[model samples]
Target: MDSHKILSLLGLALRGNHLAVGEEPVEAAARAKDARLLLLASDAADNTRRRTVHFSEAGQCLWLRLPFTKAELGRAVGRTSAALVAVTDIGLANAVANRLAQLDEDQYGEAAERLALKAKRAAERQSELRAHEKNVRTGKYRPKPRRTPEDSSPQVEKSPPDRRPRNQNRSRPRRGSPTRSPHPYAHSRPVKKGKGSFRKRED
Candidate 1:
């Protein structure tokens, strides 16, 4: 039994809804004869281990110690520490138990465990939020100040933009003598009708 294969199968059992976690649930499953196999964490409390063992024996089901500690088991199951987990499906239970018997660690189980932990974190976060809210109600909560994006990132101070007009940099054209025009009729006077001033001579 490869440890990874066992853990992977357990993870699959959990995902497939073929497994149960926690003492009460496992006990209930065992009592109902729904549980086919039981997995106890190596570091489970003595009382919990004893109780689970008793239930397993009474239910005529086989119980095995997992390679992982209680914390690791709980992490895999999306809980703080799952002392015992039961497989409800006969096929999966058999497969998991057989794999556990072959027991060497592998990489596949790590992915399963990581994925299980990620799935459980959302619920844990919500629980934490609720706890924080309760603390607030009791006036025992001190929320950490939020870090603004501006505060977290480096800020460069820039000089304020010049408020003067855009053309201020260019000198005003001096108002002096009028510039000569390039047109041929630059000095031509206004034309008058029935008069000879700057017009055709009287015929």
Candidate 2:
């Protein structure tokens, strides 16, 4: 196996902040479902291996026993010693696994293939999300029509048409005639009943 190249890739991942070193961080990543792949040093203790297995199951990720020892893995990640590491990025995880698979097909081939498929799907989903967001910003997204209660309710029966003429129920004045005044004195005017004097007689 090209251990040097693997170590270089591990260092790159660390530098990119894609790696979670040590048990606590790895465990946190696994529990949060952020871990894509986990690497355990070949020299790790039995208990650590058991915990890595548990974490792999919890995170639904793959775990591999690296060919390098704890010290080598630690140096690659700038740590004193590291028995376990988690790769959170799918693309990086796939790259690292592919390299490992090239070195040892029996051990890493299946895992590399799985990570590749996962990375592809993740990329496709991200593209789809970006397209959807673009459509919304460009005013091309068509929202589904909303259904209201009135739409779903049964049609109401129409009221029967009036049998009488339209003007029969309404008292309307003739066009050129004036309407009756409500006030009794509205039409009262002074009259010259006694000669040149105009007087309003009391009714």
Indicate which candidate wins on TM-score.
2
Tens-place lDDT per residue, model 1, 145-203, is 99999899999999999999868865455578565567979789877766664666598
**Candidate 2 residues 58-153, lDDT tens each?**
999999999989999999999899999999999989999998999899999999999999999999999999999999999999798999999999
Alpha-carbon local distance difference test for all models: 0.76, 0.93
Clash number for candidate 2 = 0
Least well predicted 10-residue stretch by lDDT in candidate 2: 190-199
Candidate 2, residue 151: CA error in Å? 2.8
TM-score of model number 2? 0.73
Clash pairs for candidate 1: 1-99, 1-102, 1-103
